[model samples]
Structure formats: C-alpha cells, structure tokens
Target: MQKFPAVLSVALLLAGCAMSSTQFDATREALRGSPPLRQQAIADCTANQARRSLQARQDAARVMNVSVRAMPRTICTRLVAGWSSGRLSYDDYRSAMVGSMTPNTVRIIQGR
Candidate 1:
C-alpha cells in the first residue's frame, strides 16, 4: 500500500526519539551513580573546612597567647609537624596541642 512507507517512517522516527531519550536518561543516571566531580567537590569542601578550623584555632591561640586543647587530628598532625620542624618547643607544643588531635586529623596524617 502507498501508506506503508509513511507508517514505517513515522514508526522509525518515534523509535529513534525513544532511543535518544533512553540514552540521555541512562547517561544521567550513570553520572549520578558515581560522579567524580561531585566526589571531588565533597573532598574539597572537607579540606576547606579543616583549613578554616585550623586557622580559627591559630587565630584564637594568637589572641589568647595560648593554644587550645582538643583540635581535630588533621590539625594536630599539622601542628605537630610544625613543632618537629622547629617551629615550636616539644614541651610548649605538647601543652598547647594536647587533646587537639581529632580522628580525621589522624586519618589525614596516615594518608587516608
């Protein structure tokens, strides 16, 4: 029949559209499942938070002329590294930095 080609073309067009939509959705879901950019974004956010906290402690210590105890482990190792590098005394460092070690800081030091 003369109508057969028209029907076939229309069906093919519809099928192509369906396939395109499915592909787009699949791509989106795949990206959502394990997005590297999002993972990196979270990591960056965590690092920035740690940096700000450490800075806040340093600033506070400067104002008080005494470092506070119980810093996050990440901050503590950084502080300890500073001490080991001759930036601070072992005794004074211990006094200034006790209880400041957070688990996250420890993890950071351990290369986690």
Candidate 2:
C-alpha cells in the first residue's frame, strides 16, 4: 500500500537521525568509531575495579612511558595490576596505554 512506503521511509529517517554514543562521550573525543575508552573492554583481563583503588597514588608519573592517571579507571587498574604482577609485559602496557590516549582521526581509517 502507499502508506507502507511512507512508514518505511519514516523508520529509516529516524534510524539515520540517531546519534551514536561516541557523539556525546568526552573521553572518546579523541577516538573515532572507537567509543569512549570506558567502553573499551580488555577481554579476559581481570582486575578488582576498586582492587586498584589499589594505588601507588602517584599522579603525572610515567611507567612504561604511559601516564598513570591518563587511562580510564578500569584500564589503568588492569594495567597497573598486570604490570606489578609481572604478567603484563612492558611493551604490552605501553602499547595499550599509548593507543588509548592517541586521538583517533578519520585519516587513520583511510584506505591506501
């Protein structure tokens, strides 16, 4: 029916107008397509969220060239715990930290 086509277009329009969570997350401003780091989960990574409340309590300090306080709470805690436990390698922590802090730009996704 003619009404069905109109209804379909309305549905598509509504869906298109919807904004993704990244549009509003402050931490994710640096990351494109990547939601806030708070949304980035480390699979199989285990840390007591408060367990690393769990603090060296140092700010502006660098370990593995990563800012101690710069990362999201869950990520920072896991990184610290994993590092201290000797389970996470220096390279691992460094890569994860730097990657998290790096601003994500559209250029990163351009096809060569």
Which predicted model would earn the best TM-score? 2
lDDT of 2 by residue, 1-112 (tens): 1111111122112222423344323222332234343233222222222223323312212222334443224343343233233443333322322332211111111110
Model 1 RMSD to the real structure? Answer: 26.7
Could you tell me the lDDT of residue 83 within candidate 1? 27
Q: Residue 105 deviation, candidate 1, in Å?
A: 16
lDDT of 1 by residue, 7-52 (tens): 1122112122323434534433443465573344334433432444
| Model 2 TM-score, all chains together | 0.22
What pairs collide in candidate 1? 70-99, 70-100, 71-100, 72-102, 73-102, 73-105, 74-105
Show the colliding residue pairs in model 2: 30-104
lDDT of each: 0.34, 0.27
Where does candidate 2 have its weakest 10-residue lDDT segment?
103-112
Error of 2 at 59 (Å): 24
Candidate 2: residue 37 Cα off by (Å): 24
